[model samples]
Target: MERNAIILAAGKSDKFAPFTYEKPKGLFCVKGDVLIERQIEQLQEAGVMDIYVVVGYMKEKFFYLEQKYGVKLLVNNQFGKKGNLYSLYVARNYLKNTYICCADHYFPANPYLNDNPENLSYRACTYLSGKFREFAIDYSDAKVITGFNVGGRDGMAMVGHAYMNEGFSSVFRQFLENEINDFGVSDLFWEEFYAGHQRSLTFYMKEYQAGEIYEFENIDDLREFDSEFLMNVDSDIITNICNTLGCVPNDITDINAINAGLTNVSFSFQCGGEKYVYRHPGGTSGNLIDRTTELFAQEKAGKLGIDESVINMDLSGWKISHYIHNARNCNLEESDEQLETIMDYLHRIHSVDVASEKNVKVFDNVAEANKLMEMASMIKGNLKREFAVLIEKIDILYDAVRADAKRLGYGLVLCHNDVYEPNFIYDSEGKVYLVDWEYAGMNYAANDVGSIICRYDFADCQIERYFRAYIGHELTDDERRFYYAYIPISAYYFFCWGLYKGSIGENDGFFFLSSYRNMIRFIDVALESYGIVI
Candidate 1:
């Protein structure tokens, strides 16, 4: 005897509202298991191996279940416009003796628990004892279904599961075919067919006690039953976010890719009529970036009004913040007034009060970057020769910086380690906003200056002007020399960044390769000045 299960999950689930706006009702979790996953498990326990899911709304989410459970998916393209019976019609070929259920419904125990594995066909129902308000049934003296009264005085309610034997399957298929061919009745529910053909077909009604089954009619209903249902759902990130903000998934109207960093991807989205920025951290092999500390710094910076408004963040490294409308990435090409404002902005960031307990250090960043380079060297092909040369040059730079460290006057202050041109956003209101704090930490302030010079290619005059603007005086000999050498070191670090990112198969506008070329040029110039071999 072949036993198969079919789950009707093709309806759009518009009644569920906000929750279904971003995900299908079938994917929602009650207690610990996703709604459909629970049904699949019960079917399996009942000795049914082949499970077919009919999906339509947000069908892509079902792919994960298909792979994990080894079930087949049948798509109903007209799901958005059609009803549940259309989903069943699409799976007509599998009408062989089968068990059918709804994706959005959950049963505490299998109704087919003790039945003979291959003997009979029955419709699962429940007597009225709870909030279930769907089709109410009337049974004959022989315990067969006589008719259904939708939303009528409910003594027995249809619970969305039924078993069909080969004989019943053949009759149901002919009823559907005749309805489609002769009466052109394609929009009727599968249960409606049983009602219309009661003279020719009868179903044994197997009723369960109330509280044994549930069909979620809305998000509020589901939330009331299980308070942590949002978190139980595998799509916790999206659902928890929507619930906390008092907004639905449909409120998130647009998601525009803002920028792609070596270790993070950012996007701008509009939610509930307000714009926000979302940061999605990328995968990394080693501890290249500490997101915990990064979030800490971001919180501190937001308090100081140096960063955007942070809405929500978690250890998972995903963040949502307020989006500044009409803000442009600041560069040296901006008017002198704008550049000076950006200079003041950087100084202000350096001046922010550092929490004494935050033990985040600067060299931790270099250690992280070094790990990336090591991982890259192991993975990347044909770059061994070039990488070897870069490493040698970096070693020389490291030695020189260490020998000169005592006299450099490099202040250990909070620094935005990646202060490239795009990291600074200038709004039309003349307020300079610093963004992308992925590498922010307590570091030598000079390192940030060097990063800006190399990143923007600031002319000697512009560099001098920025230094004067920031320090309120001319640069001391020690400061000037340290800044000059630090430029090449920063460039070299970024170049290794390119190699690391490329090895990981990341292709964000060829960022890593560009960093490599800049590193070579700066290394040669800075090394020649120090009387070191190029």
Candidate 2:
């Protein structure tokens, strides 16, 4: 007797799209093999002589399979119009003690289908069985019972793929007839016939253990699936990431410097005779992976003339840029033009047209001020009185700033939120690179500009000249007012962020708090220098 198999590949996968837009669910590949092909290969390994495939959506793609593998093809005319049960019904005529299963699931194929005992009519169900879901046999007669959801369990009577015997076919035909009579019944016809029936002999098989199984359900899942492994590395992506900083993987002498950036963690490795940077995200707060994907999409869009090169992003995840060797440090005596380049780069990034949905407000001055006051109220240290007075002054200043902002109808742009000299990297060729984009979003542009200007001490003549050059134009009275106002507001925002970080016990929380305290002191000094009361 020849063994045969029928593959169910007709379901309309509505949930898996975009990723599945061009391919059928049956053709969805893991590693390299398509699901249906894997199923076919398994059946062949099981020594099944003939294989029948029920193809539906994008069935044309699988037409070559019959010629390539010499398998039989059964088409379901109502493929997309009907469900799996209908597809099964259309292939009923081809059933000859055949092994029927879904194409989507991964299972092994071995042990010729004809090798199973002819006396047994049912195979055991593995998933939903027993207390521990373990296979146990009755000692007296070596019969299986009590554990089977239907009735029999271990040797009570075993069934495998051999059930396609003439008697079983008659039972199956009767099952289909019963389903046809119950026209209003919404349940799958096969479930009613096979699930609770006692006559169906059942046997247990070991669990299929190979690769992990994951059911893709949504766009997020698709994104996750794509990111789970590297994409086509043979593309220009690896080269682009290497050229970003004028250095290759070999140039990373001090691995510590390479790992300093908080956005991503990087490892050096060689692939296909070339070195590469393999970086993973540092998680959600600063989602490096998501940012890399967005940057890659934007770059592709820009190349197609669909968008502007606002961020100057390179390839995705592992970006390669011309690494600047022997980069010059920005000293107090640095030329005005050097400072201008840094400020311009920062301005370009802060003014990019980020989508409104991604434009999240990370910090609000009023709310931050209130949080600081609350923190002050909770303090039991020696600086309690000083903190109390400072909170009161901060509240008054916050209210004044809010009122002024409302009166002026000022709108926000993307601000770095954390702008300091260290975050700005200057190459030896005079190009500037902004490192961290974690706190980047829509906010007052003055907040970033003010933070940069205030944090760096420019008491020297050349430094002050550099500062003036950085802005390109003299600050207007209104702009100056906002800049000065932002100093304290930004300080309070940092202070609150520090307190939150401290509450969560994040790494170096005290360091952030100390930095916030320094910023506060700087704000007070700026106010005194301008002869303004807090």
lDDT of each: 0.71, 0.50
Cand. 2 Cα-lDDT: 0.50
- The ten-residue window of minimal lDDT in model 1 covers 507-516
Q: Which ten residues in a row have the lowest lDDT in candidate 2?
A: 251-260
- Model 2, which residues run further than 4 Å from truth? 1-257, 262-264, 268-279, 283-333, 354-386, 406-409, 427-429, 454-467, 496-534
Model 1 clash pairs are: 498-512
lDDT digits (tens) for residues 1-534 of candidate 1? 768888998886656544464588888878877889988988887778799999987888898887788899999987755556677788988987788888988876775565545456788887775544577788878778888875655488777688888788888878776665345255666777677887777688887776788877766577768877645555554664576577765465555565456676666667788888766665461246667667777876777777766777766677887777688777655467766776666787788676674566564334555766677778875454756777677677767665666556445677778876777776667677777777878776767776766554456687677666656778776566556667667766676677676675665233445455556656766666557886
Candidate closest to the true structure, highest TM-score = 1
lDDT by residue for model 2 (1-534), tens: 566777777665755432232456667654455667876886787677588888887778789888888888888766644556666677777666677656665434443444565534434333323333223333223333324333343332222222355566556656665674355332343433444443553423322222233334433443355442123212233344445544443333211113323344444444334343334333223421235434533453334332231334533343332333454455434455546655665566555555644424444554644654455345423333546666566566656655666676766655555666565556555555555454554566667765554444434353335445545667666545555666566666556555544443344233355445545655564455345575
- TM-scores for the candidates: 0.56, 0.40
